[model samples]
Target chain A: MIGFNTVEKLKGIVVVVGNYGSGKTEVSINLAVNRKRAGIDVRIADLDLVNPYFRTREARKPLAKLGIEVVMPAEKYLKADLPILSPVVAGLIRRPSQLTLIDAGGNDVGATVLASLADAFRKTSVQMLQVVNPYRPFTETIEGCLKMRDEIEKTSKMTIIGIIGNANMIDETAIEDIYKGYDFVKALSDESRLPLKFITAPATLLAEIDTGRFSCPVLPIERQLVPPWIKAAGLKK
Target chain B: MGKILMKGNEAIGEAAIRAGCLNYFAYPITPQSEVAEYLSRRMPEVGGVFLQGESEVAVGYMLFGAAGCGARVFTTSSSPGISLMSEAISYISAAELPAVFVNIVRGGPGLGGILPSQADYFQATKGGGHGDYRLLVLAPAGVQEAVDMVMMAFPLAEKYRNPVMILGDGLIGQMMEPVEFSDRFKSEPSNKDDWATNGMATRNRKERNLVKSLFLDAELLEEHNLVLKAKYDRMKQEEVRYEPYNIETDYRALIVSYGTMSRVCKTAIDNMKAEGVEVAMIRPQTLFPFPIKAIRAAAAKDGCQVVISVELSMGQMVEDVDRSVQGKCPVHWHGKAGGEIPTPEEVVDVVKSFIK
Candidate 1:
């Protein structure tokens, strides 16, 4: 197993933004759970207003059970697609927990919401990381990845300091996909000059992988933003 | 290209392109606006036409115009948008034009919610429009199947020279899964020179092609209706498709389901088998030329006592199930329409209640 000490570097205000369907909500939930398991104070804001389904708020019960704070719109407006950023989001930004994670929506349109809270983010030591799933459409190549980064940065008015590789085919993920994903993000980090924060492998596949092959930490993804059917079957890893 | 993880909406757009469809017209609606978003950028790169009409009403006519010229055209919309387009759908069907329409169904009667629902079954399978016409409806359960269905829908539409509908739900549009675009389903566009309104000189024909739904003479209109009925009858014979699961186990209760809701029932059946309970399922891939014969045979199995139509709607498909069973055994409807999908545990309990 890989050491999780490197994840300790993810402190203060960290925002997860990426292209559509790049698994930002899953990564955000896992990061919050990982930090909480490490005995750190964590508060996550579900800022994904673009997507109608599969937002971080769907995992509120399990996350709350883990003693991690999950923030989002009020109950009345929970399922609404309206972009309602609660007052508590600014509070989370101003008075940062040990780990303050913002799971932004997908693409430039999604990240545009972050610009509204730019003033609150200015006061904090904020670091944004773009989650890259190489198997997805636009992020299949380094050039596409760079273009997305530019669009997101321009919209959010935030500087992305690192890259997080989250390559998988959902249930079809294999070891080769992980290694290839690691190599792709490694090349991306080299070309873009952004630090390689970490790459993720499904928790089920972690035991089969060698952590020494990569330079950055390996974040074991325990999928949380699944359909209700998968949830009822207890299929979560 | 190798397998790539794609949202169902985006995959539907790409699948149409790969299947030689270059014309797309749409109006944005959740949980399916992503299809328009993906194709808006993609169509330009592929030298295809992507137009966002002023409304779904206008978009329906856009498809009619393009499809009348024998162009392979399609549109994606949610429940309410489809309601607005049903008028055009009747016109297109009357003129016998080939077109594809995809409904990523959301909870609705009137903008009910943006969550997944299967309530549109009646609209898609029966006539949503004002006429005696039926769409060749294909329902896909997962993202990969969505891609395959979208690709196949084009050819299926052209083959029958009528509108074909791909019936999916919000989950099928929003969920991400790995898909590979294979050339297995690709085919050369069918020759439309005989009926297409592509101008006489273009095809070197002396007669101008006319496309219209209005048949003024009563006898001619009756003849046209009979012709349409023949085509529909042919479809009933050749196009029915379904998948039977766990039938070899001599299941006592048979479940009829489709789309995303069927996947939940599948999980329940698998789990129930381990607990020494035998439950079977029949998942319909085509809703219009529904697999009634197969369903009837499955329901008539020796030990089968009850047949249940499990769906995401209140009881839409159950009507078809009841008709298919024809009193072979008591048929029951078990589902929800409030956008809250019945979980596998709930499905197990629902089926268990009938068995005892």
Candidate 2:
């Protein structure tokens, strides 16, 4: 029916990069959670120095309880506003787990952080994926997506092997939006010479969506990162 | 300006540009980084400068430098980031240089989780850094209001030659809403020829204009302090802004709040009204020059029973509400910190607890 077959194929160090507000962090978190749920030893690292809100570190307790190691800088440096990476990041990269996902920060400035760790990743099979949200600015068109992919690869010193379509507006996201985004991402994939690994849709929209229309696996997003007011509406943590 | 759906963070960025404050220097922080990201691309197009400094601390100084040169400049940061900029904020205030700062506040004390919180209320209102100075603080409640506030902040900062703050929570920064900007604030670039440290040659003067906050002599420093105090007092007399909701009716209770918390309070009040429970509310638009008189009047209205302070912090602004109430009625506080936003139902229950 759907492509767990493709998701099952995900291995080694997987890094997710995209333009700001492209929902890369959301995809990274769900990917880690899904891998762990699928009986894999998952460890996700938050390298998103570009944004502090909605990063994986915020959901540490739940992910940790699920035996998913959420790695980031130490507690003392959490609010330092400096790009201080945890020493454990290199260790995790060197010795890859069953599923090790890295949620990189947005754009070239953020991708540059991954360049220093490039040597450690050289030993392992690394799948660097660019996430595209058609609703966001740079990823909305084919040319913009291609431009972003070039910039991210140049800055991170890693080639993007695949693309992930993660398109949504918080509460207003609908099924058609996901379908529309797929065509947008497909064109990006063709032009950039990369495969679409998966596309994300909120868990609520899954039943209404025709899984057959999509060529890749659909990543059902369990909306973890939300505004405080929405958090109050029974979606806490 | 036509209505367009935009995130509050991005809208604030566009609003600043629309207001003609093009020089922006900021470090990336959650909830507010979109402002910097948007400006980074948009500023170059507008022939303006957008530079991300080493940290929030460095960005604050960059703002001072640019503003000293008579440029309309600003920066955006989150709670902990603002703490780093506090030192520069004090210096800018003392130097009497006009600059705008937006605080898309998140939970804090130290490394507090990145969720919405009003914990920085005291830090923003009472000087965060060491000095006798005040930032003209404006607390916005929603996305459109946030855009308007950022657009208005520039002129207000220039009017007083002081740092103006747009204090909003993560909710305001992250949410999406339709907004349209007008020249309602009359935000033209302020003429800085009188005191700005732009080159003396440009201003047709021989003496070099020094932009600094240092006064080594005690008497001279005291006089400078006095002059700043006079300006602040004038602001107190003329610049207080607030909104009174359901106050025209003889309500049974009054809830005082600002920023994101005020919206929650409004929802609670509306929910209660449907259940035959009417409550008045006082939402302050300006936090420093708090609407003391308006709050007092609201609290003393004919059928009002008590005043309650609703906040995203433990109770930072409650003290201000208490001072405004001035023992006229019993004052209580309800809040949630560490990113726990109180629900409208919870707020309604809290109100019922006291009244019942």
RMSD of 2: 5.5
In model 2, the clashing pairs are: none
Model 2 C-alpha lDDT per residue in residues B186-244, reported as the tens digit of each score: 44454677568877677866667678899999999999999999989988998899998
lDDT for B217 in candidate 1 is 100
Docking class of 2: incorrect
Per-residue lDDT over B1-356 for candidate 1, one digit per residue giving the tens place of the 0 to 100 score: 78999999999999999988899999999989999999998999988999999999999999999988878899999999999999999999998989999999999889799899999999999999998898999999999999889888887888888999999999999998899998653543566776689887778567778899998999999999999999999999999989899989879899999999999999999889999999999999999999999999999999998999999888999999999999999999999988888999999999999996
Candidate 1, A48-148: lDDT as tens digits: 98998999888888888787878999988987888888999988899989899999999999999899999999887899999999999889999999999
Q: What is the DockQ of each candidate?
A: 0.81, 0.16
Candidate 1, position B325, lDDT:
92
N/CA/C clash count, model 1? 0
Worst 10 residues of 1 chain A by lDDT: A228-237
